[model samples]
Target: MAKTAKKIGSSAERLLKVTEALCAEHGLESVSMRDIAKAAGVSPSVIYHHYESRIDLLMAVFRQRFGMLLALRAPLVAELEAQAVPDVDKFLYSIMAPIAFMRSKGEDGAMASRFIARALMSSLPEIKAEVDAGIRGMRETVDIAQRAFPHLSREEICWRLHFTFGVEHMTHWDNERLEIMSDGLCNARSVEESITRAVAFAKAAFLAP
Candidate 1:
């Protein structure tokens, strides 16, 4: 039974890796179960055996990538919640730092980041629902934001948080654009700098009236 479980885990991991690469290279909607099977050198039936449908496979990939991110941020987030005075900068950093850490992990990490980027931008109902469900977990962050900015309405805080998602996503996805636009004067590859700038930028945006 242990051996069987190990084999199942390995196969699922292989399928996820192949699916992530294909989805990253050729957007989420463009990839099919057959395409994933071909890339992974498995049969389509095997893919179906592991996942109920294309959306299920995609959600698994989404959960897999974001699960790492949530794990990284969980401790930091808990620390913020424990603080008597919420440090907006630290709160923002807690969110962006994990993404920067992921982006610094080389090609595999980049593929994961790309998959996340595609998932965030996907308009499919299934994808959106998953994303919304994930965002609901941010209630703690929202509570922190409310405490930090008492004057802001919950609606406004939610909107700013949504905007923060855009900034965080772009910082990872189109980071190279900054370097190109800056003519090498700026370094987009520096994870520390990226986190610092993203946190500072988001902090200001959140504080804006």
Candidate 2:
């Protein structure tokens, strides 16, 4: 029985991996269960056995990736909360570091990052609601941000955080646009540098008058 359960779990994980890659390479809306099955070397029926529908599978993928990110950020966030006063830079870095770590993971990591980006723009209402709910649950970090900038209205803080998300999303593209714009003087590829610059940028934005 344990072996059977293990086999089932492995098959589901393989389908998720194949689906993530396909969704990242193509767009989430373009990838079908048949595509996933073909890529995973399984049949459509097999996918159905594991997932009720394409949306269900996509949600599973989102949950898996988002859960990983939250797990990585939890300790960082806790440490910040333990501080007498939250450092703005450290507060932002706690949020950004997990994402940077994921992006540094090579092909699989890149695929996860792209899929996450795509998920954020997913048109399906269910997917959007799930993503929104997950983001809402991470309000602890936002609370830290609120403490770091008591002068900023909660609404303004949220807007700046939204912009911060945009910056973080752009980094996943790895296009080196910054390098081109700066005539190769600026590189956006270093994870530490990216996080530092993003933290500084966000700090300024948060503290803007």
Give the candidate number with the greatest lDDT: 1
Q: State the lDDT at 180 in candidate 2.
A: 86
How many residue pairs clash per model?
A: 0, 0
Q: Which residue runs does candidate 2 get wrong by more than 4 Å?
A: none
Candidate 1 lDDT over residue span 78-125, tens digit each: 888898878888888887888888878898887888888888888878
TM-score of 1: 0.91
Q: Which of the numbered candidates is closest to the native, going by highest TM-score?
A: 2
Model 2 lDDT, residue 205, Cα: 74
**How many residue pairs clash in model 1?**
0
The CA lDDT of each predicted structure is 0.88, 0.83
TM-scores vs. true structure, each candidate: 0.91, 0.92
